[model samples]
Target: MDARFLGIPELAEAPSVAVVIDVMRAYTVAAWAFAQGAEKIVLAESLDDALALKARHPDWVALKDGPPAPGFDAVNSPGLLRSVDLGGRTVVQKTTAGTVGALAVKEASLVLCAGFVVAEATARILRSRGCDSVTFVVTGEDGRADEDLACAQYIARRTTETTTDATGFLRRAGASRAATELTEGVRRGAHPDDVALCLELDRFRFAMVATLEDELMVLRPHDVPSPTGTAAA
Candidate 1:
């Protein structure tokens, strides 16, 4: 298998399998939403698109980067989702890095979103599916944030059977500009637990896979069986 790492700028013409990583915190929020019983997540490329979808559904939650918009339930924060009820509900998400990177990979055969929460399951799925080539796209804050790159490198090392300094990677990510901004947000009493949640590794066992359904990109959990003869939930 051929696995390569690319930044957000290279997402337009990504490889057959594209793994999008955004650790501080888009995909991390996504995984939490899924764990909280969200039916599926629709990734919108723009705020307008998310609003339009919300207008039609009326009950679905529309999530954006900053403060929550009027009629929207919350912003892109995992900590906020803890108090929200998302049973069998859909979430429309639009973000600066993660969703944009996902939309740009139209040429990829398969697109999977990942953070530290689902990194191991993602790697296991890729290996089980026998993918010949894959590209890890780090959708950083300005197309180059350390947290996203570290998450991508972690997944790459796992899937490629390579050794990497795991502790050092996490330490560098915690010291990154993006991570520092999130920590600042926490200190200011905004989603006080988001920074810590985003940094946790292997918090969830299921990989989130993006698929096109009726022209919309929807993300759902993919269960991959582990070596212990049980599926990762």
Candidate 2:
């Protein structure tokens, strides 16, 4: 299978299988929420949207938001997600990157969620389903490039099947700038612990993919048919 990079527009136009990557934290938090036994996930494109979902499903989910600014619940930090009780509940998540990316790929045939936390599982799910083509849609705070590309590289590494040459996109996108900024921020006493956590790969076994139910979009684990010729549905 060949890997492709698609901006939101292209993603909206073609509509094929896609893996949304938001590793800096939205999907990472989703992974955490699932680990905490969240029954379902709703990835909203905006904070207002997420809040509205929370308003409707108050008992089932917690509202989590993360904007690009500091000191806002709209920020994407895994540690913040752990501090809450999401046990057997759902999360109406609105992150700057993840949700937007998810929304962008709404036109895709299969919009399976992907991130560093479940990179390997995601790859297995994709391969098991025999995804011959993939579009790595990177959503950002304001549609920025860095974090998503980092995640794309992670997914690309696993998608390659043999070697982990994930550096192509990173190098092409000049990931060093963000690397520097991240390191400097850590040196300046900003979220050093989180910086470490974000870089770790495959620390989970879950896979969250979007599915349609009564004309609504939602996330669920990749429990579909396996590529080993076994029925999973």
Candidate 3:
């Protein structure tokens, strides 16, 4: 198995498996929704696409970044999911970086949207697949190591080295611009628990796999048995 770390811009060059990370919020929100029992999630290319999907299935829950749009149920905030029951409901989510990056790579056999919350599970899934090549897409990378990049680094390392502690990379993430803004966002009335929620390593036992079902980019949680018998950190 070989692993490559790539940014979202180079998604086309990705190989068999791609893990697109949006640790600051998007993927974290999805994990939380799944934890709350969401049936499936659709990663829309744009808010309009999400709205259209929602219109077709009016009962579907719609979540987007920032403030809620006209048809969206709420913003993609993990804290908010704690109170909602997403059981047996479809969720449509659109975001500036995460969803766009996740939908960009079309060639990979397995594509996963992830964050710190699903890092260990994502790695376990990769290990179980015996992937020949895998790329971790740093969705928010911009010549700086931010939360997404930090998560990719952590997942890639955990994929091959289960014994690797996440302390160092997490320390780096804590100081990154994205994490800094998250804390500030909380102070400025963003979800008070979002920052902590986003950084909770391996919070879920499953990984959210993005699959092209029919014409929709659907995301569903997958539980892959640990290949190395590794326990969650």
What clash count goes with each model?
Answer: 0, 6, 0
TM-score winner, 2 or 3: 3
Kindly list the per-residue Cα lDDT of model 2 for residues 1-233, writing each as its tens digit: 77876655555464588888766656777876777677788777666666666667657564444234321233456665566666677666665557777877676788877766777678777766778888778665343567666677667667655456545544433344434555466322234455445555667766788876655568876543445655442
Tell me how candidate 3 scores on lDDT: 0.82
Better of 1 and 3 by lDDT: 1
lDDT-wise, the better of 1 and 2 is 1
Give stretches of model 3 more than 4 Å off.
143-145, 186-189, 227-233
lDDT score for residue 142 of model 3? 42
Residue pairs with backbone atoms closer than 3 Å in model 2 (clashes): 65-73, 65-74, 66-74, 66-75, 67-74, 128-227
Evaluated against the true structure, the overall lDDT of model 1 is: 0.83
In model 1, the number of clashes is 0
Winning candidate number (TM-score): 1
Lowest lDDT sum, 10 consecutive residues, model 1, at 181-190
For model 3, the run of ten residues with the poorest summed lDDT: 181-190
lDDT of 1 by residue, 138-170 (tens): 888545788888888888788868454567668
Pairs clashing in candidate 3? none
Report lDDT (Cα) of residue 163, candidate 3: 98
